[model samples]
Target chain A: MDEPIQNKKVDTPQDNSDVITMRHIAKSFGDNAILKDINMDLHKGENLVILGKSGTGKSVTIKLIVNLLEYDKGELKVFGDEVKDLSEQELKKLRTRVGFLFQSAALYDSMTVRENLEFPLKRILKIKDEKELEDRIKEVLDSVGLPDAIDKMPSELSGGMRKRIGLARTIILKPEIMLYDEPTTGLDPITSKEISELIMSMQEKFKISSIIITHDIACAKITANRMMVMDKGEFVAEGTFEELENSSDDFIKSFFKL
Target chain B: MANAPAASYKGILEEAGNQVLFMFRFFRNIFRFDFEWEEFIRQCYMIGYKSFPLVGITGFIIGFVITLQSEPTMKAFGAESFIPKMVAISLIREICPVVIALICAGKISSGIGAELGSMQVSEQIDAMEVSGANPVQYLVVTRILACIIMIPLLTLMADALGFAGSYLGVNLSNHVSPQLFFSKAFSSVEFGDLLPAFFKTIFFGFAIGFIGCYKGYNSNRGTESVGIAANSAVVNASLWIIVIDGIAVQLTNALGY
Candidate 1:
């Protein structure tokens, strides 16, 4: 029985250190415990994948990190500031630095692709200079390799294209950290790979730290520098892909058996 | 599972309590948080400006038809002078606001519900929160505020259109001049009849927006939940409007208004 990987100690510049850290986190819906005593650290420029079977609270973990779901007990800190205690204005300011790609791509259907991408930029950031806004839109869209999708409605795009557009929207703010919630959940194998590759490429290009929640082993193996498997509301294993492959735990072994 | 009757009754009571709590929280949030002014303006545009054409057209047609249809009956009584006053009081004091609300309950409530339900299904609301935006303030508050501002304006427009329609209706039957008709209408209207009807619409607007947003915001299950949210929003909002209107009428009558 291999022991779980010891939590790594992250070295920070005397000036800057943790981007996000969660301590003793727990959440429940009625009597059902969704997450239990979760502790994790996300450092700068690291891609962390949370691998879990369906209904294992993988998405809940992401939601907790982003303050989407309030935890019953815990301290969640983003940029070394306590998230739960922040004022509304402070929360809005913090959001400018984080980008999230929702599971369904979650594009506003009433708006065009360009408008969807521009929504946060204009509404939240108040970027009124038309040329600069257009340039930013083009840059993000080009980075995701969908430069031509500007005028297209979300319904007009393919699943892969929509995910790419979602990625484009997520990175529009040039966030320091990105959260991807099952980014490839419903796509074909080929499209899923495209999304996985895009996720990796985007992380590398932007030097952005990421937490990706997915059930796709192929995606986890290809993109995660470090991976954690969660089962029944707790993390059972955490290690590099090679280290996890050599793990002897029945749950971990059987997970990758196919 | 075998507890049967007692357990089932308890479950029903629990569901009822939860609904009451939901409504209570929905109302509380409006006053508890500092109102977001920009969002309020945006909502006003959504609820008021966008809805004007539909409410306006409907009001006009209803008024005109009512006058045209009622002329013969009033003529038989030789009380043709009372046509404008009757139409004015009926439409302004009751019919117009309820009718506009029903139409809006269909249009705006369903729209808000479907939009929010899709967001819930797609995790967009979660995305907003994670992005450091308050999904409630950003989405729900703006919409409800828009209703607060827009619904009354719509009702007022409906009242005017109903009067115009009555004017046309009267002309079709008898040659009552516009001045004569309006004078008769004004003579019959008091502050009592006008104020309560107008005031009650604010509650109507709040109900429509609140229900639509609540159903949509809390929707779960999956893709189909959006449709269910939209349907429920319309159904619940229309029901609440009628209920509230009835209460308002009773209260106004009690006060001798």
Candidate 2:
């Protein structure tokens, strides 16, 4: 498959300063080193796609960015605050500004779609009024193009619809940065394209910076402003899609071959 | 290739040992009250309030059946008048708390284990941490608190219902009135029997919730681990309840209760 067009800059409403930066981040589970001395920068209003084969620490990197997984050694900054030193109260405040779409959608099975969307808003943001909560829920649902499915259970939604709802829930708080992990993994090709389109629309509409982690070359091509290829828990190459395609690195060449 | 089976068995045993160690660590964390008070309240609601009907029903049935069954047995010794005493002692000191623990082990333990297991498998727990929610405080404390509060309340309700059932059961064969039955039941139940029994249930509730939450929260691997967590939570909690109850019985006996 050919690489998607590389658009360096598209005019958007949000600022384009550095949104997230990691310096020498290292994480290990017991003796198993999952990430090692990793460094990366994610700019605001940019969709940076991280491409790696399975178990290459792609998901772990996303976790670290959100401060979900602690790094044994290294500094991580989100919107200028050092994430490691922040207290629990401070972290909850920081988390509200960031949105994440989990790979499995991670929608609470016991909750309805509306409750799922309302959960963080009510629990974390403490949005109490019924009228405003309903309005915000409808607004996010409409943005994700699923306004009518608010009363439905998660089990009732199709794979693609669930992913969209997950995306909607992530954006309900209007986070400044969106981290999507394998957003298109289990979808049909057409559904995958729809998800990609939705990602683009979100970027355009919200102008939020995004970090999408996936093994899908097609997804990386369509969604990324900048792309990084990872191998064995380390970044092997990084650039615009065109720049990476033209590189002499055998792994990058072969990765893009299919 | 020839050594694969032997190696796999060894690996399984090692994994089992590690799981036991993990359980010990979880106990340590619970004693430290790892999560916040608000989180504890939420878990109490989940474990206790949500499980009221099942626990209530179990308590009622056990009380009724024990009364009916003991009627025939006591009649053989012309001790049919002692039915209330027997039912009261059994419910307050043994059956009520133990049954509630077992029921909770089934309901709350499995529910917590499955909930946490799914959270772990689905990575919501991870998401919480990433989003700056303290997963430990958010998940662990709420559940532990729920167990502590709910278990005692459930036992209290169960104790009442069981006595009612025993009264009804006694009426089935004999003419013992509700008033006479309660009086006889109370006369046999001193503070010694009631205090230790009720007190031990708090620990029972705590054990079930803590072990279940611990199992589920730490669960990894894949879908199968969730089942393992649920299973282990119930097994460990029930075992601990029995062991703890036995110790309480011994201590009470030594203290001349």
Q: Lowest-scoring 10 consecutive residues by lDDT in candidate 1 chain A?
A: A1-10
Candidate 2 chain A least-lDDT 10 residues: A2-11
TM agreement with the true structure for every prediction: 0.83, 0.83
For residues B120-238, write the lDDT of model 1, one tens digit per residue: 88777866666554567678877887887789889999999889988888887578788898999989999888899989999999989989988899898588999999999999999
RMSD of 1: 5.6
- Per-residue error for A224 in candidate 1, Å, reads 1.4
Provide chain B TM-scores across all predictions: 0.91, 0.85
- Tens-place lDDT digits, model 2, residues B1-257: 98999999999898678766755654555565324565567666767778778877888889889987777778899998888898899899899999889988988888899899988998777666555445665677667767888898889989998888888888877787778889999999888888898889999988887788778988885999999999999998899899999998998899888
Best by TM-score: 1
Error of 1 at A74 (Å): 4.2
Output the lDDT of residue A75, model 2.
70
Interface RMSD of each: 1.9, 2.0
The runs of at least 3 residues in candidate 2 whose Cα sits more than 4 Å from the true structure, single-residue gaps closed, are A1-16, B1-77, B132-142, B164-179, B250-257
Q: Residue B22 lDDT in model 1?
A: 65
